[model samples]
Each structure stands twice: as structure tokens, then as C-alpha cells.
Target: MTRELARRDGLFGPIRVLERKHDGARLYCINGSLQTLMLADGVSAFGYVHAAKILVAEAPNVLIIGGAGGSLATMLATRGHSVTVIDIDPAAEQIARDFFNLPPQVRWVTADPLHFITAQEGVFDAVIVDACDSSGIVSPFDKPGVIADLLMKACPRGSLVVNIVAEDGAPPWGGWLAAKLASLGLSVCLFRSEEGWEGNEILHVRVDGPTDRLAITDLEQRPPEARTYLMSLRPHVASHVPVPATSDNGAS
Candidate 1:
């Protein structure tokens, strides 16, 4: 069972907050796509977010290029990582605070990600590209050149994690993206559900990190649930060769 907690027209389209009665999990949906899910205590409820967290656990500073419900930012901030989230929609920040319980410590920047990346001065230890809208990955992020620029400008020596939604067990652009980034001298890894493409596919790319394995740092500090989820994920280095593009999955 679920209840509609709030709804409003947002820049992307209709934005909504919904609560699941059984688990008290809150969902933030934009343009009919489920962007975030948070537990009652404000922890991320998505497995892919937890997986991404593990990939960046060693990094001290993190930049997330999409706000959504701010779950990823909140999770990182609570873990003592400095986190900044940039989104084009100001309403995303407001709704995240108003309904998703986004904490005050996470810095919120309302701007186009491409513009922010070009003008930003400070470098982050890790950068996550999770930007998307109703159709799919928003503007320039869908293109490889923009992502390459983001790496050059904001995270020259850090990690870049991208969240890709998949359909029928494969991401439309994951294989190609992995190959592209790898060609630029970055080690790339892909993480997906063992059960198949039931959720988001996470791509972890790094300039100087090992591609062989993912290690969970400060494991003792993680909550029992987070520890379990983190330990369950399997990550493998992405192929340097690009796979044929699959049909686009509208949104998730």
C-alpha cells in the first residue's frame, strides 16, 4: 500500500513524493521516473546507491551531478564525506528537503551540470553523474565529450561513477561509455544486480585506481544493513570494446 504525500509541477514535469505504507519508504518521482527512494530514517533504499557508495568510500570529497531526492548526497554526508549535489531544478532541492528529509549539511547547487563543470574551480575526490529526466539522461551528460570534459576539469585524478538505467539486462550506452572512458586511460568497472538488470547499472571509472576489485573501506562504521548490501555487490572491469547499443529504456 502507498499514499501520495505531495505532488507539484516541476521544471522537468510532474514531481511527486509517495510513501509506502508497509516499509515507510518514501519515493521521489520526476517526470514519471522513480528518481530516489529513502527509508524512514533517511537512509538510501536503493541497492545501486549503496553499491556506488562502496566504490567511492575512500574518497573524502564527492560531487553528485544530480540531486533527485538527495539520497546519495545524504548517505555520503552522513558517512563524513563532504558532498555537493548540483541539479538544474531548484524544486528538486526543495522537495528533497521538504519530503525526502535531505540533511542541511549537503551543499546544494542549482545549475546546469555542464555549465557548473566548466566553471568549477575546486576538485572533488569523486564525481558521480546520475543526471536524468523524463526521457533519459539529461542533455550533455548523454554525450561522451561532456563527460570527458568533466573528468579533465573537476576530477583529473579522482573517480567518476555514472548511474545508467538498463532494459532487458543491458544498458543502452553502458558498454560504449565504458569503452570510451577506458580509451582515455581510465580503469573502468561495471556493477549490476546478480539477479540481472533489475535496477540501475553503475559504472565506476578511475584515473589511478585498481580495476580488479572493489574494496569497502571503514566497514566497521557501516550499519548492519549497509554492510550487508555493500558486501553483496559484485563489480567487474568493463570491456574496452564497445557492445552494440540496445534500444533505449524510456526512463525509470
Candidate 2:
């Protein structure tokens, strides 16, 4: 059973916090989308978070474009990476700390992600763009040219991960964004779950690197509880590629 812990109006719409009695997992919802899931111990309960963690395992510094409950920031910080999360909603920081257990060690910045990306001087080893709202991915990011420019500025020579959720059979924007980034000389891979249609599609883009597929050896070393979520990720070179019989496409 689940119980509501808190509810309030946020920058986008209604924000809610819920707790599952059986497992003590907290759910952070924004505009009705499951923005984040955190376990009782503050560990991330979302597969996409694990998939992103595996992809950026070697990075020492990370920048997250959307804070939400700061699950990705928390996971990365716990692993010794310097994590900075940016959100336009000032209330997100407090809500995450109060209900989602976002720790103080994770740096929180309140500003428009686009402005932060364009103005920040610090470079990150990995950049994850999970920015969204009630409708879908926020503006500027929805436009290929703008996101490309911002990403190039944020992590010019590092790994990049973008999370896009599909709702009501809506077209997956990650596919087009992948093509745009690939055309600009980045090695891009799109990951999706084969068992279901309604979920997140993560795009992994390498701004400067060999065209080798991502390695999942590190994921095998993660805690057993995360194995199922990590293994669900399947990579596609492009949106049009057919799913291979084997899930050998490496980490998401």
C-alpha cells in the first residue's frame, strides 16, 4: 500500500510525495510524472538512474540539468563523484531533502538549466539532462540546435546522458536528438526497454571518443538489488535499428 506524505503546487503543477509501506520507497511526482524514486536508505529505485550511473562510472564530476528529487545526484555523490544538480524550482531542493532524503553533500543550484549551462564556467565529466515538466521535455531542449549548443558547452569532451519519457504513444524525442548529435560528430547510442512500451528512453552521447559500445562490466559489480534494472537497458545505434536477439549492447 502507498500513502501520501505531502502535496503542493510547484512551478509546473502539483507536486507530490508518496511512500510505499511494504518497501519504504518514496516516490516524487511532478505534474503527474514519476520524476524520482528513492529507497528507504536514499538509494535510487529507478532503472534509468542505474543505467546513467553505469554510463558515467568513470566520471569524477557530474552535472544534472533537472533536480526533481535529486536521485541521480544522490547516487553519483554516494559513489564519490562531485555532483551538481540544477533546477528552476527553488522548492525542489527542500522537498527532495525533506521527503526524498537528498543529502547536503550534493550541490543544488536554482536557475533555469539553459541559463546555467550557457553561463557556468566549470566543466563536468558527465552531463545528464532529465529536464521536463507536465507537457514533456521543456523548451530549448525540445529544439535540437539549442540543446546541442548547451551540451557542447557543458561537457565538451565527456559523456552525456539524456532521459526522455514517452506518454500516450507520443514520439520519442531522444531518437531525433540522437541523430542530431550524431550528425555533429558525436557517437550516440539510444537505450530502451524491450519488455515494455511506456518508459524512459535514454540517449548516451560521447562528444569525443572512439565508437566503441558502452561497457557494462561495472554494472555487474553493483549491488544485486540493482541488477534487474541495470539489465533491462538495451542499446540501439539509432532509433531505426532492430532489437537484437541478444541484449549484448552493453550498459545503457
Candidate 3:
């Protein structure tokens, strides 16, 4: 059941605050399609809930691009991680604070994430990016360029960046995305969140280091949806093996 409780036309686009019976979440669906941000039982109803659990395992210094509802920043800050959110849309700050109960500890900077990161010349232990709008969808932040920029913004080594992709089937996007991350020298683990929105996948990129399997069983601090998704994962990694050399008779 869906009911449009309230809505407003703002700089980012049409923001419709809807009530969903399934999760009891007050969802902010941008332009009647994408559920960009949400709040449930005073907690985040967005993918960041899952992200927070993932970050808790590794990231301490968190830099969030595309502030959106400020859920990610709020979530990380409450966990004692240094959090800073940069968003191009100024309205998001107000919306986040006014609606989502974003905490005061999380700093909000109104600016284009790309420009801000380039100018600051800073590094972070973890970077969480969830910048998507209602219209004109593209490969989660246009994978290549943003991924490259994100990797640079990461610490010298062992820094991880998580990109929440609204993915679909496979092939060009999924396969190509992995290839791009690999080429950029980042070991990537694509966690498909089948329980969340359709085609939801969390791509974790650890710059020049090994990323362990997501601890789904350890879902103490995570949300119900997140725990369900994580629990679905059995914790494993794909091993790449080269073809063995053949001897005299084409058999070694």
C-alpha cells in the first residue's frame, strides 16, 4: 500500500513523501519513481542502513558524496565515525534535517562532490557514494571517472569506497563495472542486495588491499532488511586461475 502523505517541488526535483505499509517507512520518492531517501521508526530506511554495517567493520573516517537524506552521514556519525557530507543540492541539507532527523554532529557541505573532493585534496578511510536523481539514470555515477576520483580521495592504501548501484541483469554494466574497478587497481567485491530495491548491489572497492567477505552472520548493528540481505550471503570470494600448461600430448 502506498499513500502520498506529502510532497514538494524543490531544486533537486519533485519530492514525494510517501508512506509504505510493508516497512512502515516514510519514503521520499523523487519524481514518482526512485525512492532516493527514507526514514523508518526514526531510523534510516535507505540502503545506507546496510552500508553502515559494512563500514563499521572497516571505515573510521567516512566521506559521503551526495548527501541525499543525510541518512548515511547520520548513521555513521552516531557510530562515532568522523562524517562529512557534500551535496550539490542545497535543499537536501534542509530536507535531511527537517524530515530525516539528521544529527548535528554530521557536517553538511553544499557543493558538487566532484569539485569539492578535487579542491580539498583530502583522503578518507572510506567513501560512501549514493548520488542518483529521478530522471536520466546512468551507470552508478558513471563508474569510470567517479571511481577513479573516489580512489584518489581514499587514503594511500587500504582505503575502501562503496558505491550503491541500482543494478539490473548483467553484462555491459555489471561485468564492465568490475573490469573498470579492477583496472583502476582496486579489489572490488560486488554484493548484490536482492532483498532491497530491484537490482540493488553494493560495490566495495578496497584500494590495493584484500577485502574479506561481508560478515552477514554478524548483523548485530544492522537493520532488518540489511541483515536479511547479508544473511543471504555465505561469505566467499572468487578465485582466478590460469589455464594449466599442456605437455607433449596436450595433457600435462
Candidate 4:
């Protein structure tokens, strides 16, 4: 009962709509030999859009991993923030351009985020983690101190956020991962949706300020209905997962 819808957006090379869902239509990029799956309306691109919408300031340097339909990238560009998005899937980049109307201010890099983060030296005002494994895993590349160190080293007195998929009340990584990051001196905050699509976590790591003073209420402020939607996706804060540690520069 599923089929590919034809292209309509001229800006995007070749795009298609898979089907209509509760939130929006599932989208894809059909320009190349490979079919790149894009967004799932209310669900697939929801987390990034919500998070991006509440960003406190316009950042000159920003890095995004797992450009989901380019929602976050587009939103940031519209707000006058320079964005660089890295995705392992070229199809994803095309789909984001074609279907989500991602703008050119959002530079694109087709590469693995882990490798790129390790190899780069540019410090950013913000770093976003939206990477996902094909097997439905979210960033299994854990070395405890690497993420904190990277953000601290690369960001200039700014913040970093990572999205996770878990149930409400789930202890993401049994609280070990978050704790490790905190021990390294990054202010942390957790955000979730009521719909339970994917457990979203927004961890704010401060570079040159008191970590405890960083306020999360601003970025997370939402209307009752919106809060309801956010609460729906709250991963169980106590849920534990097997986060593997990498040695010698985070290479598998």
C-alpha cells in the first residue's frame, strides 16, 4: 500500500513523497542511483526542528550530525546562523535539500561524524549530535571523555546538545554517560517528547562559564500542548544501554 510520489520542488533535484502519516508525509530523494530516505513529517524530523527552534543565539560556527531532512540546518540558516552538516548518507543530503528546503548557508559534508569531529580543529559555538546507526542505534561510539573533551576543546565558551532514543524515565546509558560528561564539567539537561517517538536529550556543555549556572528552561520552554508532545517522547530516564568505548582516536 506504499508508493513513491513524484517530484514537485524545483529547488531539490528529484524528490518524492512516500506516504502521509499522522504528522506529515514521509519524504525521499530520488535524484541518484540510490534512494535516500528523508523525513517522516511529525516524527522523523521532529526532534531536530524542536531543538533548533529554541536555540538562544545566532551562532557563527555550528556543526550538525545526522542531518535529518535538514530541518535543524534550515531553521538555523533562516535565523542567520552558519551551519555545517555532516552525514554518512549522501541520499540524506539530497533529500534535505529537495524535500526540506534546506538553504545553501548550511554547508554539506558527506562523511562520518565521529571521524570528522576527531580530525577537525575548528571550535564551534554549538555542536549537535543527531547521528543514527542503520540498525536503529544512536551513536554507539562512546569513550566517556571524548565527547566532553571534544566539545570543550572545539567550542569557544558555548554549548553542545545530543539527542538520544529512549523511553520516558529511562536512564540513558544508566546515567553513566551523562554523569561522565558532567564530571568533565559540562552542564547537562534532558528533554523528551510525550509521543515516545525517540528519546531526545539536550545536554548543554559550557566552555568558559559555571556549568551549574547554565539554564535549560529557556531552550525547553513550550506551551502545554507542545510540552505534551515533548513529554510523549521522553525516554525512560533509567533505561540502560550498552555504550561501547573506543580507544586510539575513536576509530572502530
Candidate of highest TM-score:
2
- Cα lDDT of model 1 by residue, 14-66, tens digit: 99999999989899987777888788887876667877787788889999988
User: Candidate 3: global Cα-lDDT?
Assistant: 0.59
**TM-scores for all candidates?**
0.85, 0.86, 0.76, 0.65
Query: How many residue pairs clash (N, CA or C atoms closer than 3 angstroms) in each of the candidate models, in the order given?
Result: 0, 0, 0, 30
Superposition TM-score, candidate 4 onto the true structure: 0.65
In the predicted model 3, the residue pairs found to clash are none
Number of clashing residue pairs, candidate 2: 0
Give the per-residue lDDT digits (tens) of candidate 2, residues 1-252: 899999988887899999999988889997777888788777776677777887888889999988988888888888899999998987799998888777789989999887777788888888988876443466656655665676578887888788777555545566666766676767788887664333677788776674235566776555455666566667777544232222222211
Candidate 2 all-Cα RMSD:
6.3
State the lDDT of candidate 4 residue by residue for 17-76, as single tens digits.
464455344555434312222344322345434554454354667887767467667667
lDDT of each: 0.75, 0.75, 0.59, 0.54
Candidate 4, run of 10 with poorest lDDT: 33-42
**Any runs in candidate 3 off by more than 4 Å, and if so which?**
1-6, 19-24, 36-39, 46-48, 133-140, 166-172, 194-198, 217-222, 234-252
Provide the global lDDT of candidate 2 against the true structure.
Answer: 0.75
